[model samples]
Target: MRVFYAVVLLAAVLVLNFSLMHLAPGDVADTISQSMGGADQEILDKIRADYGLDKPFLVQLGHYIGRVLQFDLGHSFFFNQPVTQLILQRLPATLLLVISAQILALVLGVVLGVYSARKPNSIANYFVTFFSLFGYSAPVFWTGILLLIAFSLKIPWFPVAGMRDVTISGGFWIQFWDVARHLVLPMITLSSIFIALYSRLSRATMMETLGADYIRTAKAKGLSNRQVIYKHALKNSLSPVITQAGIQFSAMMSGAVLVEAVFSWPGLGTLAFQSIIARDTPTILGILFFSALVVIVGNLLTDLALRLVDPRVGGRK
Candidate 1:
């Protein structure tokens, strides 16, 4: 059933993305002409026909859908390469950034949340609240810029941008360290928002669970504070946090666009940015399509995780 819904949603998204691209102002031929230093009507017509832009709207959409079903993203006009290949080349970078950022966010957020929830009105709770607000309110691009300047400029702690410096000659470990150095800023920038969200949610839910009847009963039954908090309360408190994790996962995937552009990360988001500049329809649509799929899968995984954590979830119709 989830698969069916995802398919329907993807179909609608593809249609909308394609239609909006065609409907957007400015002729492809005109843009092509400008880029190529002015081509005649014959050349322009051939270009349009070759790219199937000369076809009727419905016909073009039909062809596109057919190609999509076959796992074909078609060729990128600007890049002069297969869209799938371009996406595959960039997918790993984005995945590394997203996965690393989410892991950092999850671990740090859960830790801070648990600690703060136990502390109540202490300094630690206030610090967590302040950090959450700062992360939530700060713009992605701005945060990225600050990190870039602080670490890459004044302090000289990391590289300013790109995934890796292939220019350096070294073995695997040397190259790995170089890439990890470059990844630090963007990952921090991307993960900050997710950390803010998860930490706040965890703190709130944990606080509620700490006050619950079961938690009180556990304390009454001679369970230590650590056991009561971790073994009992925290487990029950995680359902909402788990749900938010799915949502934030999707959020970070989408938010990567600004973060990628800021740091020149050479990921899916950077590819989409370039494609948009050159009006590369195929590449743009392909990125968007794959991104939507990722978000959907993240949500599905979240739902499954929730069921596992608390069997009562989805146990009934």
Candidate 2:
């Protein structure tokens, strides 16, 4: 049933994205004409006909849906390449950035939340609260710029832009380290806000979970503080955090656009930005479809994780 719903939802998303994009002002033809120093009506018409943009809206949409069904995302007017190929080239970079940020946020957030919850009146707890408020309030792009200025300019600890050192020539590990260095600022910037959210949420959930009857019973049974909190309370508190993570995947993807733009990372976000500027409908639409697919798949995986964490949620017992 979940798979069935996902398919239906994907189809709806495809149709909606196609409709909205095509309905927007200007298109690839206009962009091309402008780039070519403003062509005559005959030239513009020829360009439209060549790209099949001369077809009626319904006919164009039909062809688009048919091609998509076959995994043909069409060609980019500006890039002069297949949309699928272009997206595939950049998908890895975006996935790396977004997933890395998410993992960082989740790990740090959960740890900080748990620690703070364990000692609500401690200095560490106060620091966590302050940090959460500041991180949550600061914008992602602003964070990236500040990191760039501090680490890349003033401190000179990392490179300012791009995914890897194009100038460097070395072995796999050296190259890996280079890429990892470039990834640091962007990942940190993207994860900062989410960390704030997850920390606060986890703290609240942990506090409540610690007060549960089972938690008290576990302590009464001679369990140590660490055992009671880490083993008994932590798992129950993670449900909401996991659920929120699943729901926030799409927002993280959106945030990646700004972060990628700031750092000049060669990812789907950068590709989407360029495509939008050039009115590359095929490329933009393809990115939207791919993004939607990723979010849906992420949500499905979240469901699976929840089932593993709590079998009762799936009625497995």
Best by TM-score: 2
lDDT tens digits, residue span 62-167, model 2: 9999999999999998899999999999999999999999999999999999999989999999999999999999999999999999999999999999999888
Task: List lDDT for all candidates, in order.
Answer: 0.91, 0.95
**Candidate 1 lDDT tens digits, 80-190:** 899999999999999999989988998899889999999989998999999999999999999999999999999999999898887886989998899899999999999
How well does each candidate superpose onto the true structure, as a TM-score?
A: 0.95, 0.98
Off by more than 4 A, model 2: none
Clashing pairs in 2: none
Which pairs of residues have clashing backbones in candidate 1? none
Count of clashes, each model: 0, 0
- Model 1, residue 78: what's the lDDT? 85
Q: After superposition, how far is residue 68 of candidate 2 from its true place, in Å?
A: 0.8
Which parts of model 1 have CA positions greater than 4 angstroms off?
169-171
lDDT of 2: 0.95
In terms of TM-score, how similar is model 1 to the real structure? 0.95
